[model samples]
Target: MNPTDAPFVPGVPAEHQPATGSAPGTPLALYFHHVHPDVRHYTALTPREFAEGMERVLAEFDPYRPDDLLAPSGPVRPDRPTVLVTFDDGYRDNLVHARPILRELGVRAVFFVCTGLLGQHSGQPREDYLTWDACDRLAEDGHLIAAHTRTHPHLDRLPPEQAQDEARASLADIAARYGPGPARLFAYPYGGIPAEPGLPGDVLAFGTVRSPAEPWHSAPQAIRRTYLPSGATGTWDGLVRHWRAQWQPAGATARPDDRDDLRGERP
Candidate 1:
């Protein structure tokens, strides 16, 4: 079916839609960047706002950890409202602000870090990203630490060989520091997926497609993800509308409506 014919949810990038053949109860993963009290960027969420939003989600859905959803030993329930929480770009706020809240809420999230940036300080407030020690601490706290690229770059804009090195190097970096388990998972910098799709080696990669991922979906390389907006009131409103669209009656057909919930945030 044409993706356009599928449901359109506000705040969600409509480039990818739920497929009819998708596995039942496939997870909807939400990606966040910064969770600082002072919102430096549009995608950053304040501490209070992040807590409240997560609480609301917990009320309606079951948390899907990497083990349960990514590489499950048991079969996933077809009717479960399963969701995975993910944070991109390793930031100190994730450990200081986001981690405590998530721990309190009993939700474990996946953190994708740029291997090269770990332990490097720029002396900028709220920009002194996570160190390797912090990443180890995060893992100790039961959260998964994955690779995001050696240095966050637009792989699409680089030569194929350089791009391949960037991707592979990061995975190797994480394995050397973190371990092989975490190294298996990777996310493209800026959610940019190359034409070839998945990375060269055995890795489950993610992209910013704003849709739920199926267990054995055809596009395994580009696992779709939705952004959890934490900017202005309008962005939150769009997120709420998208949540409603996602949880509508199973058989309900959505009216054809086209509105960009994350319009201004993107160039």
Candidate 2:
């Protein structure tokens, strides 16, 4: 079936429409980190507004965690488009304003949190970050809790040893707080870190800035994401356009004969 003609999957939302003119095998993914009534002004959404947005999302897309949706999980399917929702910074607005909406929609997401920022003054008035109890509640609700490092530092700028420490310690803290299971996901601060050579085995997925060309071929750890802004042009239609543009071919599709050459010894 043509990419555009593919029927929308049940439980997946419409705002995640595939790119116009895309063919089968084209890779596509959608991402969102924050959702507020007005992001230009960095304000939280009112309960009613949040409810409306969730209702819209629930009608169209399957919200997934990075590991389950991305990675060496095989080639992309045009009809079965997968959208992953992620929230960075573990803000209280997530627990206060976003969680209820997500729960209402029955969509699960991953929250990348800075453990060090947890019980400290938020610098912003009104308890901006999520409390430990709130984080626990989110996890209990089936949302994945992942790391954004301990202090939200720029790991790329840090000394190599310090960077390693940050990565390890942050994962440790997240495991401790959320219970000792495998910790698989991570998000870099400000999208600054490169994929390291020897990350801990527990880490499964990491996030990076979205690149349209080669959208799905980044470092195994570097999953790409599009930022969702809130505004007049930032309506649900705007979100669909942004995702569609990213689905455009980064380069010519591989010819069937080239598959062997591309595989080489990688497999």
Candidate 3:
């Protein structure tokens, strides 16, 4: 199916709308960047807002860790809401600002990090980036520590060979350092086209936004996410709209009578 096309909207009678709390056919994987309040970058979400979102989501949906969903496990609980939390770029604030609230709520998220940015030898330090120690702490606390790449770059913009190399090297380095389990999960920097021409077949890569996974999900490399940005989603209401509602339909069939529950958040 074309990722750019509309999501698989079941042909339940057009009048038969799914309730806000009804289980989605698949989990809604939510991705985020910085979670600090003081840094008002367009993508950053304030701590208080994030905490509030987590509380609401936890209350409404069952948390599904990346590994659980990637396992192709059967009997996906369609009786209740399911959500997968993921973060890109591995900012130190993931450990500093986001972790505490997640830890308290018992929600284990996946943090995809750039391997090159963690150490002194890698080059000049970006204090805002995460350290290996911090990732280890995140893992120790039950979060999935995945790879984003050795350095954060738009993979689609790189030469095919270079893109493949970046993907492979990061996977290898992450496995060497953190072991192979979590390394199975990869997230593209900038959520560039999720597929690199030559990355390993086994790598389960993720992209920024592609409709939430449909039931019977099997394509790990093209896993879709609903990215959360404080700029687009207010701290509280935005969380409810995103985590609780699906994007409004956009195909030829989308009627003028359809409610605008959610607008396009991705560029």
lDDT of each: 0.66, 0.54, 0.63
lDDT of 3 by residue, 29-94 (tens): 778787876766535778887887677767766786555633432223333356788888778778
Model 1 has an lDDT value of: 0.66
Global CA lDDT computed for model 2 = 0.54
Model 1, C-alpha of 251: deviation from truth (Å): 3.9
lDDT of 2 by residue, 1-267 (tens): 222343332333354322231222233333444454444232234456556644554444445443343234332233333355677777777776788777877777788888888765555534367777888898888887888888878877887788778877878888777654425567777666644524664344444443222333334355555433333223555344444433443553534432221111233
Q: Say which prediction, candidate 1 or candidate 2, comes out ahead on lDDT.
A: 1
TM-score of each: 0.77, 0.67, 0.73
Q: Candidate 3 — what's its lDDT?
A: 0.63
Looking at candidate 1, the ten consecutive residues that score lowest on lDDT are: 258-267
Name the weakest run of 10 consecutive residues (lDDT summed) in model 3: 258-267
Q: What is the lDDT of residue 256 in candidate 1?
A: 33
Q: Tell me the deviation in Å of residue 204 in model 1.
A: 1.2
Ranking by TM-score: 1, 3, 2
> Candidate 2 — which residues are off by over 4 angstroms?
1-60, 65-79, 121-127, 179-182, 195-198, 208-218, 241-267
Residue lDDT tens for model 1, 1-267: 222234343543445332221233345677878888775663578888888877766666678766543342222332445567888889888888999999999888899998888877765634579998898898898898898987899987888888888888888888887677777788888767776543744466777654244443445557777654544444444353344345434565533342212111212
